[model samples]
Target: MKILHLETSSRNCSVSISEGKTLLSTCEEISESLNQSEKLHRFVEWALEGASLTLRDLDVISLGKGPGSYTGLRIGASAAKGFCFGLELPLVASESIATLAHPFLGKEYDVVIPLIDARRMEVYTAAYDGATGKVLEPTTNKILSENTFEKYQGKKILFVGDGAKKAQELLVQQDSTFLSEVYPSSRYLVDPAVERITLQQFEDVAYFEPFYLKDFHGVKKTK
Candidate 1:
């Protein structure tokens, strides 16, 4: 099946075109500012053109439902639903956090954690089985401390995502590795997405919403 994937869970705005397990085209840009409202559609067109296809050619519209930026998640979800509506295709959602762990699935680690910065020292995160990609610790928000994640200490662990650096600073561990600059992208959003499609797990486009782990709190005015 032909699929189009959209992921804008962080500063990175990404789009990809895939067909049954193979990635055909992917485009992404990580800007200091959140500009998904400006880049998403353009990247979608670019991806479709690069893949030599069109919106009507797509069978499913997949999105990395986020626990990241509120605005970014809104942009991505609106665009995904728009495409599904315009093309009359099925929509499926994948966890944006999982996209962060995809690259390290078969690496030298016993567990993989994807972290998204939340309020202050808190983060939205979960642990995935490093080898099988299974959800080990379910997603939730955690306030970072030196004793954080002590349960998974004996195993070699990889802490990756935009918030990994924070964990590295406090959650001290002997065998943990941190990669803080990493962000979710559509390039790695296709596999689990396709698996969802294969299982016929289409979302209710009318009511689907991005998983915002915490409520949005605007910044205070400096005056």
Candidate 2:
């Protein structure tokens, strides 16, 4: 089974192709000059061309449906939906938080917290149990403060995401292990896609949407 994965939930934009369990190709660009809307197609084309395949050869298209940048998520979702519709392939929606936390899967952490910056002091956060791959808490909008996650003091917590750097500064408690360096990517999007494909779990492309934890607050035009 050939799968195409797209991740644009953060500042970095990545595209990857996988054939069954093997990763065929990956292209990543981290630049403010190129937005996902403009860069995604080019990256996908490059991956397909490099792999000596075409969009028609893909069996599934997986996307990192996000809690990160609203515009980025929309661009990714739109592209995924378009490809699914055009190629008549199944659409797989992988959670952005889950994708970021995918690296810690099967580990022995009591809790895994994946955060995405939501601007200001707010973030899109979720808690997962690494041992069981169970989400202890569903994704939600949270504001960082000194008292955040204070109740889980004794438990072993591993924190990761683009927002981890800021979260680390506020989470001064001695109990938590802050992984401020981990960032989301297409590499993390593959395993979840494989799992979903094996389970025959597919999304309805027509009605599918990105998971933006908060309402988008972009600049309004004054006409």
- How does each model score on TM-score? 0.96, 0.90
Candidate 2 residue lDDT tens string, 74-192: 89999998999888899888888887787886787778889888878888899888788798889998999978888767788888887888988888566677785565688678888
Model 1 TM-score on a 0 to 1 scale:
0.96
- Which candidate achieves the best lDDT against the true structure? 1
Give the per-residue lDDT of model 1 (tens digit) for 38-137: 9999999999999999888999999999889999999999999998888898999988988899899988899998998885899999999998888998
For every candidate, C-alpha RMSD to the true structure in Å: 1.4, 2.1
> Which residue pairs show backbone clashes in model 2?
none
What value does the lDDT take at residue 125 in candidate 2? 92
Cα misplacement distance, residue 110 of candidate 2 (Å): 3.4
Task: Provide the clashing-pair count of each candidate structure.
Answer: 0, 0
Q: Report the poorest 10 consecutive residues by lDDT, candidate 2.
A: 174-183
